[model samples]
Structure formats: structure tokens, C-alpha cells
Target: MSGIACAVGLLSSKCILSAQPQSAGRILLQYTAVRYRRKPRWLGTAKSKLFRVPERHQQVEEEVAELKRLHNVYHTQMKAVRRFLIDEVEASKLVSRAGMVIQTPEEEASEWEQIQRINEEWNRKIGEVREKRLADEREQRKNYILERLVAKEQRDQENRERVEERVRLEKELARNYITRDNIDKAIEMALVQPMSYNFSIDLSGNIRRLGEEQNQESSN
Candidate 1:
């Protein structure tokens, strides 16, 4: 097939080169006849022969058709190549954009971590404040209990003192009443000594001594 294609190429090249001379010779012959006014029958026959050279014309036409087909094919192939190149360029652009997107999360990761750490620190500080507040409340409660206990003890002491004072006043009032009665009885005994026994004054003094002994025993 390769040898056949080579032979066809050689034959087509020779025919194109040969067709130019035939065309020039036919033109010269026609011009000479026209100038001499002696038209030859062989010239007319040659014109017919030239016209009948359809094999060469057909060959030329076929060559032209083949060339046009080859040009169209080459144009289509070039278009396909251009499309593939454009697709490759667009794909590279997409890959570059993806690379930039991938770096964003990595670049900001440290800042996110810092934010989390700050939040944890704030939470710890809040917890500490709460613990301190709770401790202060507990201390306040303890102090309140101690103050209440002290106040209660002071009140109990005051109540005991008031009871003791009431008892002392009652004893003093009874003693004063007993002393007034004893003196009055002694005066009556002394005035009636002549009318009654002469020893009534001594008897009155003895009764007073007995009352004093009874008062001393009641005090204890």
C-alpha cells in the first residue's frame, strides 16, 4: 500500500508538469492560425483532442478534491488539539484554587486553638470566683451562729440575776416585818409587868431570841 501511494504521487506530479506545456502549445497554434487567416483542419482536430483530454482534467479535479478533503481533515484535527489544550489549562487553574482553599483551615487552626484555650481559662477563673463566694458565705453563717449563741448565753445570765434579786427582796421584806412585831410585843409586856407576873420582861426577851433563831434557820 505504501509503494502504491508513492507511485500515484509521482505520476500525479509528472502529469501536472506535462499539462502546462500542452496548454501553451495549443494557445500558440490558435494564435498563429488566426493571424494568417489560414485555419487548418488539423488545428481544429487538435483542439478537439485537447478537449478530449478528460483523463488529465479528471486527474486534476480528483487531486483538487483530495487536497480539499485533506485540508478539512487537518483543520478538524487542529480544532480538537486546541480544545484539549484549553481543558488542560482549566484543570490546572482549578488545582491551584484547591491548593489555596486547603491552606485556609491550616492557617487559622492555631487561632482557633488559642480561642479555645482562652475560653478554658475564663471558665477556670469563674469557678474559682464561685468557690471563693461559697467560702465567704459559709464564714458568714458560722459567725452568725456564734453571735446567736453568745447573745443567748447573755440573756440566760440576765434572767438568773433577776430571779436572785427577787428572792433577796422577799427575804428582806419578811425580816423587817418580824422586827417590828417583836418590838411591839416587848412594849406590851413591859407595861403589864405590875398587873401580871414580875418575870414577863425576861419572858419577852427569851421569845425574841427564839424568833431570831427561827429566822436564821429559814434563811439557810
Candidate 2:
């Protein structure tokens, strides 16, 4: 058979074998192409290829020498062209720089005056802002100090009132305190009362005089 006929027949058979059958309305798809994977390096050479020798292509010495000479000439020509282009670019830049206008002394002085004016204006504006900021900071500091003073005054007032109230209470209680002037009266009252402290406490936390109950029974 012809090559084209054989190839078409083989492709048809491969497609038929690889075709996937579809349901009701879906189109059928077939894969007829073959893919090859590279052998892993760790696997080494195959057993069947161990004795195989690959043929090497040989070149004529004269042809190889001619090719080497042509390569050298090409590299040298390229280097020369690159160097000429770089020199031409550098020369063009120098010519451009040289063609720039040179300023007159008067023009230079005018430019310097303009730059100074701009610098002076910037300094003036910066100074104004700095002075305003400093003023605001001073005002804030003054307010803070005023507030601290007010708070300190309030605290001092509160402390003074507390001390005065405590002193008034102590003075009121001092009226009843024992002193040398009242010692004789206090002793006379103690002797008239003849108070006794011989007592016992019961489980109910009541204090009972030891002889008071007996004295009461005898009087009855």
C-alpha cells in the first residue's frame, strides 16, 4: 500500500481504539497522538543498548580552520563597529554640551539675586510659622500651669477643711477628758460609788457580780 494510505489506516484504527463513547447528546472524543517520556538518569543505560556504539560525524580539517578564521574576523569587525558607535555617541554628547549658551555676568548676577530672594521669602515664612508655634506652645504651657495651680489650691482647701473638722471634733471630746483640775472631783465620785470589778462572764456573754446577787437576796 501507499505510505499515505497506510498512515491514514493506522490513524483510523488508533482513533477507534482510543475513542470514548458518549451519552445521548455529547460528542465523542478520541486520542490518536502518542507521547514519549525521557528515560530517568538513575536508570542508566538499557540492557539492550549496552553494546551499541553511536557513530560520530567527522569534519574536514581545512573547512574547520576556515570557519575558525571567519569567526575571528567577525568578532574583530563587531568589536571595531561597537567601539566606533561608542566614540561617535561620546563625541556627539561633547558637541551638544559645548553648543550650550554661556551666561553673561549680568545674567548670572540676576539669577543669583532671584535665588536669594526666594530663599529669603522661604526663611520669612518658616520664621513666622515657627514663632506662631512657639507662641501656641507658650500659651499651652501657661494654661497647664494654671490648671495645676487650681488643682493644687483645691487640694489644699480640701486638706485644710478636713484638718479643721478633725480639730473641732477633738476639742469637743476634750471637754470631758480627765485633767488635774477635775482629779479631786473624780476621786470623790469614785469613792461615793464604791464600784467593784469582781465579776464573772457566763456562756451567754453576761457579766455577773460575785457578791451583788447575795447582797440583793440578803436585803430582800
Question: How well is each residue in 148-198 modelled by candidate 2, as lDDT tens digits?
Answer: 999999999999999999999999999988899998988998899978889
**What is every candidate's alpha-carbon RMSD to the true fold?**
43.2, 12.1
> In model 2, which runs have C-alpha deviations exceeding 4 angstroms?
1-60, 193-220
For candidate 1, the clash count comes to 0
Candidate 2, residue 6: lDDT: 45
Highest lDDT: give the candidate number: 2
Q: How high is each candidate's TM-score?
A: 0.29, 0.59
Pairs that collide in candidate 1 are none
TM-score of 1: 0.29
Give the TM-score (vs. native) of candidate 2: 0.59
RMSD of 2: 12.1
Clash counts per candidate, in order, are: 0, 0
lDDT of 1 by residue, 14-120 (tens): 22122223554553222211122333343333333555655543458888999999999999999999999999999999999888744478668987998999999
